[model samples]
Target: MLNFSATVNQTDLRLAIIECGRIAYERHLMTSNDGNISVRMENGQVLITPSGVSKGRLQANDMLVVDLDGRVVSSRPDRKPSSETPMHLEVYKAREDVRAVVHAHPIFATTLTVAGLEFPVDMLPEVLLTLGDVPITEYATPSSHEDAEVIRPFLKTHNAMLLRQHGSLTYGKNLDEALIHLERIEHVSEIFWRAKMLGEVKLVPPEAQAKLLAIRDAYFKR
Candidate 1:
């Protein structure tokens, strides 16, 4: 089991954050300094990416440790947590089960939001089972407490959301799951976009969608 004591060394968590950043950047989920990733330590502190740094180039030491209230507990002298820290902290506070959060401006997903489109929840069984009904949060000022408030209502029912005219936010029991959710969001968006370009997009039957949802709920129990 992982340690969560006040004195627990954060080396592993920092490395995980760094790797997540690198993967996100490489996969084009985030570019430049357009995204943030965080993992809540077992002790209730959070390790997050620093501000204004390319996620693809992040180093483990660039991670900042902060309390749930957004107070810095430890960080490199030159580093500061991402400006959207409140948004990340909100997920941790609202959903005790969420240990990691990822926010990114993925191309396809953000495009859907910019066009004011919602994910077709029953169009694909994989998406329905894995992500459920992806909600689009009302537009909120970036890096503000409003970002937190807008997403709070969906916290109990959704693991992934598209930020209106912004990007996407996804969280899970760990960094891996969170990242997977991020990737899946973009993947489904691209598929939907491509399908529209080809022809009418087919959807699973309502009966099948309901069955998949029941299975998903029973399995995730979220």
Candidate 2:
């Protein structure tokens, strides 16, 4: 499991969830009601965004708490758990270190998926150090049984990925980190897309890439 330097409580987590949902919305990561966010509590209950709710106006009380088995542990009719809860559940099941996840529909990232492109994030030092290779999950119907499975294999090694024909998924030890990745991916995607329009973009040489990765490993060692 991710060892948070500080213990995360339900109230704090709930607040973070609301704040990040707004961040996602304001950043245009998704249409107000398009994505899902979740945080795994210490007690194993999953707290998540509600279905069809506009994240811009989402509140703490508007969240739902569900068990790992996908059963509703605590909920309010005003806010029901998202249909994509299964996808978030699969992520927690696959990685004990992950405490929070952000599913967004950032335009640039989705554009890459639609164009059959994966962000060559390694081309930039900041991106190479913060995020390595960004993967794209196999195409699957959104919120379908296969959707979560399409990304299951990459969970162990990747912190973020593009969901084919869908959008993006980013996970981290907390909502703050998760949101950071959400922003970073979109920013990198835009850079790569804009750069390639002018001419062939240069890649970091293999020798230089190895050194940067070594530095990244040292800084982000789990």
Task: Judging by TM-score against the true structure, name the best candidate.
Answer: 2
lDDT of 1 by residue, 1-222 (tens): 122233445788877778888889999999889999888887889999999999999887898999999999999999988999999999998888888899999999999999888887777899878888899999999988899999999988789999998899999888888888899999989999999999999999999988998998889656
Model 1: lowest-lDDT 10 consecutive positions:
1-10
Whole-structure CA lDDT of model 2:
0.86
- Candidate 1 matches the true fold with a TM-score of 0.93
Error of 1 at 104 (Å): 0.8
lDDT of 2 by residue, 93-174 (tens): 9989888998999999999889987778777888888878888989989877787889988999999999997899999888
Question: TM-score of every model?
Answer: 0.93, 0.94
| Cα-based lDDT at residue 181, candidate 1 | 89
